[model samples]
Target: MKSALMGSLKFQIPQLNFHKTLKKPRPSFLRGRPRPPLWRAKRLSTEAIQAIQSLKLARSSAPRLEEVFNNKLSRLLKADLLDTLAVLQNQNELDLALKVFEFVRKEGWYKPDILLYHAMIQLMGRNKMVEMAEEFFGKLENEGLKPDTRAFTEMIGAYLQVGIIDKAMETYERMKASGCDPDKLTFRILIRNLEDAGKEELVDCIKKECGKEAGGRFFLKISSAQNGKVAVADLQYHVLKCQKARNFAVSSCEADLISTLLKLQSRRAHASR
Candidate 1:
């Protein structure tokens, strides 16, 4: 430092002003990192397309599109499709949706999940497909999915809608028989469908199944909707109708005319007397 001061004095020139010269730029800090894409697949699985194609190409007793679901396709199936089927059922597209569902089962990639079964039950009932719904119920049971009140109740309502009271009542019995608690909504729908069909025996059976719980809150709407006609009265009328149906069970009825042998027999009896 002393030598530089001495040299400066010696040099007697102040032209080396490095601080007054140029300056270099500094870099700013960076933040967020990029993320990987979720699903990179471009299209549906080959198995699923084959299944759908097969179903479309099918020739069968049922609609002929059943072959589409010949085998299970885990990658091809989506939860959205199952949910869409549920909505379609409400729109009375049950058979078609069920056709798709059959494919779902046939794909065998996934066991029929609980949600799928429940949706099937709901679809069957909403579309008035009673027997098919019952068949679906049997399938559910066979697959070891426990029936809740909703499952059995939906079946009961469906059977009642089609005037299959015996099946409806049987569904009720089977519900309890299967260890499900019967909810009021089910009974209400049951009573209503039965009453509509005039199936007194079945309605009575439902009431009996309901026992003291017959006076369910749902029944309140049924009563009010009927202008407060009591369920008991309704049930009795249905029973009478069922009996009337039974007394005349023939598909076609023809009364037989009196025979000549009967008249001859009567004449002989009178002469003998």
Candidate 2:
């Protein structure tokens, strides 16, 4: 009787169809959200193109280039002239770019612009034309325009590119003396390049300088994990890790004199209280 009752009671097990249960994702366009178009550089106007060609052709002869500029390119709108110069710089046409730059400088509407000088210095630096970069920097100074951090950094970078560590350090000192404070980029550029060149002493000096500049607020620490080479680690909220310093080891006190200064400052604060 028990067996018969158990056989009479049948439990139904429903099968789950996951394929029908899960909804497929719709394409962005179908969902009324399309991806934004990628940005492309603006094409140069016909007149600008012609002017660049003319300048390039006349580059062989200085007098011919001057004549071409005065006759054909001089009448260009300020916007057009600046744009043409930018294009020349992007193309790495240093000589032509300088020629155009001189013309732009002589324009009645022109003013001393540090950013323009910075761009030219960057271009020269990339080509390892250190002297030309210095010349442009000097011209900027002569124009009574105070060089900003970016301008100074580019000049420093130019020096570094030519493997002239001494000049780079001198430029950094000059930048400080001129009352232009070095930003994080300045420190990073100095530290990374100095480290790569095995100028560990200079790196230590920069670390202390940074601490002094920050007034004991922010500081950088150096670690040595890979082959016992020094690596910089920012102790603040954002850690600026050097690419070469992938593996982090214990922080070294000798590398972090900034922390020692901070400790003294803290002790003094307590003592004054």
Candidate 3:
């Protein structure tokens, strides 16, 4: 009877269909779509490249070169034309670059761009073509554009490149009289070049001017902060930190005053709060 009951209780167990429940692996390409390539500005177009080649090959005669420039290069878009000019300048082809520059200037769409003049001046300076650089600068002024600091700085640099110290100093004075204050860069360039030229007196004068400007600017900020009820200590500390970070030197008197003001302001801020 026991054996018969055991035989009756025996039943078939169903197997699990895991293949139907689990997902199949995807192909490598489908797992994640490939990222698109990054876009970048094209340095030069086909037309520009062709125009440059034509200009270079037409170097036999000025009239023939002018014809090639007019026929091929004049039709390029503004960007392409400027890019071509920049390429010529970088290649140190002074004559070709000047031709392109003059052509660009004559364009109806042309406007006074100080940066363009700056680049040309820099290029001419590198080639020791100080006269050409001066001509370009005169043209810049004739265009009724007030020379900014960079433009003046470039002209000064060009003068200095030819060891024309008097001209450089005159340009610097004109820059100041034009109400374009000399920035740190202007001071730096003047000081460095003057020192190299062994002009000790001029270097001292420049340093004094720089110090006066820095002090006035700093104290102006402090006065403004006081009016705003800002903690003088914090402002002074921040200024000192910035000065140190920028490798600026602070005199002992200035540092002591800053520390004293910082302490006084800290106490005042605490008392008020």
Candidate ordering by TM-score (highest first): 3, 2, 1
lDDT of 1 by residue, 1-273 (tens): 999899987675456564475776642111012222212322434554454445345535454442333333233446534543444443445556676677567654558576677668766665577667878888988988887887877777666555677777777877788888776576667766666677778667656555433222221112223566555322111112333222222211111101222333345468679
Task: Order the candidate numbers by lDDT, best to worst.
Answer: 2, 3, 1
Q: Which lDDT tens digits does candidate 2 get at residues 18-57?
A: 3356778853221124323211366677778788889888
Tens-place lDDT per residue, model 3, 106-218, is 98899988878877987787678899999988988898877999888878877877789999999999999999988756776777778889999998777767644544324
Best TM-score among the predictions, by candidate number:
3
Winner of 2 and 3 under lDDT: 2
| TM values, all candidates | 0.45, 0.59, 0.63
Q: What's model 2's TM-score?
A: 0.59
Choose the strongest candidate by lDDT: 2
lDDT at 174 for candidate 3?
96
Error of 3 at 117 (Å): 1.5
Q: Is candidate 1 or candidate 2 better by lDDT?
A: 2
Q: Which is superior by TM-score, 2 or 3?
A: 3
